[model samples]
Target: MLDQALKNQLAAYLQRVTQPFELVASLDDSQTSREMQELLETIAGLSAHITLRTDGQDARRPSFALQRPGSDHQLRFAGLPLGHEFTSLVLALLWTGGHPPKVEPELIEQIQALDGDFAFEVYMSLSCHNCPDVVQALSLMAILNPKVKTTVIEGGAFKAEVEAREVMAVPMVFLNGEVFGSGRMLLEEIVAKLDTGSAAREAAKLDEKAPYDMLVVGGGPAGAAAAVYAARKGIRTGVAAERMGGQTNDTMAIENYISVLETDGPKFAAAIEAQVRHYGVDVMNLQQATALIPAESEGGLVQVKLANGATLKARSVVLSTGARWRNVNVPGEQEYKNKGVAYCPHCDGPLFKGKRVAVIGGGNSGVEAAIDLAGIVAHVTLIEFADQLKADAVLVAKLKSLPNVTIHVNAQTTEITGADGKVNGIKFKDRVSGDEHLVPLEGVFVQIGLVPNTEWLKGTVELSRFGEIVVDAKGHTNVPGVFAAGDCTTVPYKQIVIAAGEGAKAALSAFDHLIRLPAAA
Candidate 1:
């Protein structure tokens, strides 16, 4: 064990660095040699990172643990840190340094200004190298900001801990006892996050022990569609969501939708939600689910938990979280969201029906939306950042058929200019001529692409590079008892009707598994 003088010096160093620094000893085994025990205790006493404890700690607390700089950036490992993972440690050091590269300037400002304590817990599997980057990024934030502390836990070594938390995937991040965003994060983004208020806290608290036959994790058109179907199946289904409508809430006016002559977006979302409620499905509003755990052998049941303390044990699980719009990753894109900004033409195009609107990207979705909007809007500008339109030949031909739609080859949107509460025009640069021009317009529809919300699911389930969940037509994950459907899953189309149909398929598949479980047991 280290000498008492060294422990006192370490403690003084930690206290001088920051305030409200707390310690949490992460002990895996109690049985050890006396020398080892003494060493651990001595280390614990000297640790500015963790507090030594005699009583065991509850697993849930780590996710919310607050950190104060000098005392908070704990990088302790029981064994020698080596192998490819050693690279992560070096990166972590770089993160702790001020002004890490690739970090957004705004994010740095937010992190530097943080005063409240926050903890970040990330679950990682052995196979996930992507997770290490996130861990490193978060660790950097902890070191830079005295108020933030981060922890990286190996999923396999923490089985009981993970089970208690109901973690369904690797590389999952929980902030302040609730889930923050998952997948990849830029250093600048992490710094920026320090300024934003916690979404999990404003939502419901986790229950840890709720009961339901099935739990659906989304509230979008796909998730709502799934919930209605699951309720009809006579299962006690619960739906948890941050917002009820998902991307469907942002549509302008869906014209091509079958059976609907011309309908607005908000109305469509409301109608779907109404239908789900008619069946008495438990819909938890302002709630976000963080993880999903499969049912274990020997009477174990699937468990769904949320950022709030609320949890539900289920015979089946349906993931219909749907997709989020993709950003250009360019400058000024974020500041323009909902200003001159838009994702769905059917949702926002009619607002500019008689005016001008510029559509970015040259995919089938972009071409289709442009073609449709050309009929109702005055001037339709289609901008393809690529050299050629990569859409199907038939779609390209159809778009060319529209006289009102002007297709600009090799054009990219650089910035959006607006006045007051609405969009007025956009700035674009010609890829060929290097000429930049501002096109006056009332709307701008970004059809670049959709990103599925499955980044946290790597190694936990099969996912395409596009981040869509891979499932059989029946909506089953590669693993048993877990099912997925809608836009978030690997389906060909991303239509509301298709999602509704897929929701039904997933429910039936889950029901089949539950029915057979009794016989098998």
Candidate 2:
């Protein structure tokens, strides 16, 4: 049941209900079922143009089928609408009543272009704040396209379904009954798989002989910024990336990014892509870079080879290829990733707030993660394989200051333990005692150092032992016409804003190099 205040808000929202809406509820007579039924009935009772109907004893499953007059069921909400997901239910009701959803035009185009029948079965927890976005996106896609159907199922209500699908995380998306991915996914990502006209084909069409004035590699914040900066100066700029947003997209939440108050990974990444496209930058997305060839002379051309047959030559290049998180690589780790196992404390920390959690790796990043989580989470168990923590004195001091965090030295993470598709605890072995211990936790954060995406540039560019590109303050590398920036470079700190600034600098430096060249490049 909902509060009177909430009911009044829903009534106001449905003021201009156009289509006749009905609640086709199918549920057992359990207490939880009763609550859900009452909630749906209450919702239907408020509007003059709305009605309620039970699916009867012979109904296939206990779920809510939202059917509008003169139309078949367009959407389904499989469980009780509790917590933040209540907003999703409200939106669904309004949507069927002729209200437009806030979806991007390009995304709608992609949805409309879908050729085959596809069903989006989204598994989510009621308490998960991030789940609703995926549900809404899929619903809107279904509304726009006849082939795509969607069902938002609450995890707790459908225990059998959750176990069958191995749904361990909120927003676990299953496309046509198979796990597509877990976590906050964007509309573009889902549509990407369905679209036949892939980027590999798109990359093939770009002229290999013609040289770009400036070519930006990597699609993260740095590359996007570099591409935009280069394009603004009226240069023949092209951005090639496997995916847009780079390492920034791997992050969960960004509060320290200056002006912005709060933002999450998927939304932030989507915004960056949208902004880059708005500037009409020649963005070659989903194109992986395999190798880089430096210019022979000062004003000569540098070549970039893609995994595909396409080759791109440029007068100037900006290597903003970002870093990837160092995974634990233990059993069940990859399978449960984004289900319960997670990396990037800033991105996924809030989801585990007030719950017990574990942080593996005792480096600066690990200790920092422990310190950050200590304030929000109930407890933090930090495990380090080495005898002593490798973090700085200040960070170590700050970590020790937190009473809620427990430190375990010379302990190795053996396995990530979970049941019915989600992570619940961790298996660790003590080096000294040779004893294995299992600590129960709601989530696990891996805070090991990042692996820079500079391996491809080993011989062509000067690189540190960690495979990070060696660069000067102005983003100049060992090669004259080539430059590097962001996490891939030997930057002091890896921040999104810092990378973006570096990208801008790299673009400006490339432009300067282009102008100084005697020959037309």
Candidate 3:
């Protein structure tokens, strides 16, 4: 299952194992079970402290459990943990074998102190970039505390179970048989959910913090750049974001990023976040900012209110809240989200394998999604509201050449039709004839565009008609001590490289504004 180079790397990593562990696998006469056996054998051969047992009585065939001798703490994988989940498997092995994890000491203690039993089942796709974080987080909890157990189920490997649960998305987490969450989640966020009082404690801590010189309100590429640039100026800096990676975490292939030949969104986001942390920036992830209160006096601290009821004060604020995927907002769309209506093709495509699916929009994202889904799905129906496809000529040509793909231009998506609590078709109308048609499919992929996450700043700052934060060339907003950058601002192109550059510009502009402030009383 693993190549020679990968085997060598696995062997090297296994050398850190200070305790003995076992890979107990339940197998059957299926091909997947055979492959699982080979994989377990290969892994056991890599380390002296590892043992393989094929007599596991797990009901799920082709499944394995990583367990320490005489310890109830365990982590299980019901399918091959390759692709993005490969890292999760490696980390589980290391952590189970007494190798130290990189998480904070406080978080480790919290995991160990959890009270109730947590049987976490994460349904994930191999192509999903966001699943590893959740899988690894739960695995860490399981390895740290005997009360926690995690089972990562590969969606592609067990299609019947996925369909039975009506799971239409990757990284769909279930706690004790009920749905817990449906997307990427941070380790801290998971613990915060389990430990209810953690939020109150964190809010109190944040309220006691001193005012920062520069405070960034997002954790995307733009926010990371802004935080790093500000911290490098020898001034106090802080970053508050709902999620550290933001929309970048949802992105798939990123070949357009300069310097780097090719990479994925999660990798790029992790790299930038590491760089920001390297500069000693105080990053508070999973903190949602609900309101912006400008300083009462000139050169005073700007108070940013968080959803947790804590307010952070900063002399200069960089608003890089970024953008989210634009929803179709048609009828049944909301009711069927993750019930067959999904925005991410890379993450949800595997769930609809050999099934018909529709892609809404004709731009690069829609066209690219169609092309990628054509291989996994039985058929791809591309719907565009414009008269013609807005994608590049090369991409359009490639899409047209696909045999299983169909294109519909000048079509408006009216509603996503579904029954039995799952999507079944999509309704659209042709602009020329005003004729409405319904395309029968099992899934709908919305790739229209992005809408700025400036809804909270509607009354606080000057925004464009399209709801983007109005910013000058220097990234300064209408507010005196406030600035905006990236997709949330008036930037023409919403590219990662452009966002990073704009973030730097906004940081520099904030610094310039700070130096001219009058002496505080």
Candidate models: Cα lDDT each: 0.66, 0.81, 0.93
TM-score of each: 0.52, 0.76, 0.99
Local lDDT at 18 for model 1? 23
Candidate 3 wrongly placed segments (more than 4 Å): none
Pairs that collide in candidate 3 are none
**lDDT score of residue 172 within candidate 3:** 98
How far is each candidate from the true structure, as Cα RMSD in Å?
21.6, 5.2, 1.0
The candidate, 2 or 3, that scores higher on lDDT is 3
lDDT of candidate 1 over 133-212, digit per residue (tens) = 56666776676666676777655455667657655344567888997865445454455466555434333334533566
- Model 2 pairs in collision: 220-245, 220-246, 252-347, 253-347
What's the lDDT for residue 261 in model 3? 97
- TM-score-wise, the better of 1 and 2 is 2
lDDT (Cα, 0-100) at 20 in candidate 3:
96
Off by over 4 Å in 2: 1-73, 80-110, 126-137, 156-160, 195-200, 205-211, 295-301, 330-341, 344-357, 363-380, 386-406, 414-444, 519-521
**How does model 3 fare in lDDT?**
0.93
* Candidate closer to the true structure by lDDT (higher is better), 1 or 2: 2
RMSD of 3: 1.0
